[model samples]
Target: MNIVYWALVFFGTFFFMEFMAWFTHKYIMHGFLWHLHRDHHNKDHDSWFERNDAFFIFYAIVSIVCFYLWSYEDVWFCLPIGLGILAYGIAYFVVHDIFIHQRFKMFRNANNWYARGIRRAHKIHHKHLGKEDGENFGMLIVPFKYFQK
Candidate 1:
């Protein structure tokens, strides 16, 4: 395929994966998998890379499988899609854990609108503690209603 074709495929797959992530985090992780993800919200001096980090481990395995499929087909198109996943992973690590939570105190201040918005949205997600969970599901963008506080 041409470069433009590859770019389109990569970005389309990337956005789909991101939407999947949001849905997974909201429903799967926050719902049935709460036992595993609870560690993220629980106030404790656990490692900066809390148990919730296991989610990335699963993601890595899926990426490897996707890469293998693409390689077998000689498509080479999925390489950029994998790169997009890596980019989103890095952004999630930096923005969600490191900067927003101040897990490592990496940033003195998160002054950006996106940062503040997501942080506030995540805060709301934690407000109910358990029952009324699954709100503010977006990792990068807030859906306005989440910040109604």
Candidate 2:
């Protein structure tokens, strides 16, 4: 409720959502759901929003459920958690898909370390298949171990 409380809630929810995303991406997306995710790995020179974007439909359902739970419990604090998840998804779409993959030319002129690093990490992830593709699983936040190479 207060400004400080809201700030804490926002930051806490952001990190928690990031961790949850990392876990889901590392396991669920790469594991059983690989059937659907495999389309992402296959190289196809086409549109910016590829078949892999379908994963966002599942994410939207999860976001709706989270918001519903937060509303039902009158836990306004958790609303920020839902927002954090949405924010992370948007960031991933923009950074990973659009910028790194050159899905869109919006950032073509922008040269920066963050963009370069993300592009490099994602390239490594796409270089191999199966367990060898484990590197750079995190979208926005790169784990230190992924860069050891």
Candidate 3:
């Protein structure tokens, strides 16, 4: 029963991260913290990294704290939650940074419906360099309109 419970908790956190990513992208990245995220859209930096990378560091710290709690403080559920958040972070890195932004060399040829849709939606979002005009913030749950050929 513990396995099942932990499994459910793990997947629940994984799925919930989509909503969290969207909300954070819409509000925080586009809000007062836009200075941190602005370089991501504006691409003004000479280096490959942007100030926006701090958000990933923030979430990584949170996941690390969850892992610490699960390991040391007897908070068993935190293990699955931490793993789930790590999974989502990896997915976001793969999809958003690697695939769409082509930060790395892999996944460039992923032309499937889902991959294409995600790329399309991200393109639309990046079309607006400014904070206010972007759309399609979520990486996994892109709008259906992007699915069309």
Candidate 4:
């Protein structure tokens, strides 16, 4: 059942990314490295990108390293782990950037309560233009309070 084990690992990585994202957002992004993440909270004109995007590069490097381990070093589990990280990255981009921030001008009319809740929670997080007092750091899994009518 190696295939099944790898599949479970992949899915586990997907869920694990939520915690990683939250921790990185709350601690790393909102912590001393806020300079890199500052523009995400406050806009930098119509630049269409933020220094915050560098966080994606960091994760990309992690995935790339995992791929290198899988291919060159024969660390077999790294393949599924890398794919899982990539998948989570895609989902985070779609949810946080596309759906919540409307960066690409899509998903504006997603009227479902879950969609609404995601938007609401992200809005709360963005309400703090400074790094000090942000909340709702998670993406796909948001607070139940946001889901209430």
Candidate 5:
């Protein structure tokens, strides 16, 4: 039963990050913190990075804290939680940065229906360069309409 509980915690945290990402992207990033996120929508700078990348640092800290709690504080569940968050972070980076945005130039050939939908939804989200009137704020889970064939 320990393994089952571990899996539950890991997968549960992974899925929950989607909702958390969506919520933060919609309310926080697109809300009062637009100064940090606006560069993502409208790239007025020529650097390889944006202020938006700071958001990833926040989650990285959370995951690292969870790992610390698991190791030093002896919180067993924290291990799975940290791993789940780490996994989700990696997935978000791969899909959003590499595949959709072509940041690293890989996964360019992943043009399946689901991949197309992800790109389409992201394109729509990027269409609005402002904080207001933005849609499709989630990463892994986008609207089903985008998946239409």
Candidate 6:
């Protein structure tokens, strides 16, 4: 039962992060914190890193704190929670940064319907250079219209 509970917690947190990502991207990132996120929509610098990367650092710290609580405070559920957040962060990095933006120079040849759809949705999102009029904010679960041929 403990294993099942932990698994549920892990998977639940994993899925929830998608909503969190969408919310943060739409509200926080595109909202008052547009200064931190503007570089992502419109690249004006030559550096490899953007100010938008600060968002990842914030989530990473949260995951680290969860792991610390699980280890030291004996909060067993924090282990799964931390793992879930970390997993989502990794998926976001791979799908958004590496695959979509080609930041790592890999995953370039993956040209399937899903891949194309993801890129198309993201392209639409990036079409808006400013903080307004943006669409397709979520990373994993894009809209079905983007999946059309």
Q: After superposition, how far is residue 36 of candidate 1 from its true place, in Å?
A: 0.7
Query: What's the TM-score of every candidate structure?
Result: 0.82, 0.78, 0.96, 0.96, 0.98, 0.98
TM-score, candidate 4, is 0.96
4 or 6: which has the higher lDDT? 6
142 Cα displacement, candidate 4 (Å): 0.9
Deviation from native of the Cα of residue 77 in model 2, angstroms? 1.8
What are the runs in model 4 whose C-alpha is more than 4 Å off?
none
Return the lDDT, model 4, position 87. 99
**How should the candidates be ordered by lDDT, best one leading?**
6, 5, 4, 3, 1, 2
Task: For candidate 6, report its TM-score.
Answer: 0.98
In angstroms, how far off is 61's CA in candidate 1? 1.3
Task: Give each prediction's root-mean-square deviation over alpha carbons.
Answer: 2.7, 3.2, 0.9, 1.0, 0.8, 0.8
Global lDDT scores for all candidate models: 0.72, 0.71, 0.91, 0.91, 0.94, 0.95
For 1-149, candidate 3 gives per-residue lDDT tens digits of 99999999999999999999998999899998999999998878699888999999989998999999999999999999999999999999998889888899998888898988888788888889898978845788887989976
Locate the minimum summed-lDDT window of 10 residues in model 6. 135-144
Q: What is the lDDT of residue 107 in candidate 2?
A: 87
In candidate 2 the C-alpha lDDT for residue 58 amounts to: 77
Residue 54's lDDT in candidate 2: 75
Off by over 4 Å in 2: 43-49, 69-73, 130-132, 143-149
Model 6, residue 42: distance off in Å is: 1.0
Q: Which candidate has the top score in lDDT? A: 6
lDDT of 3: 0.91
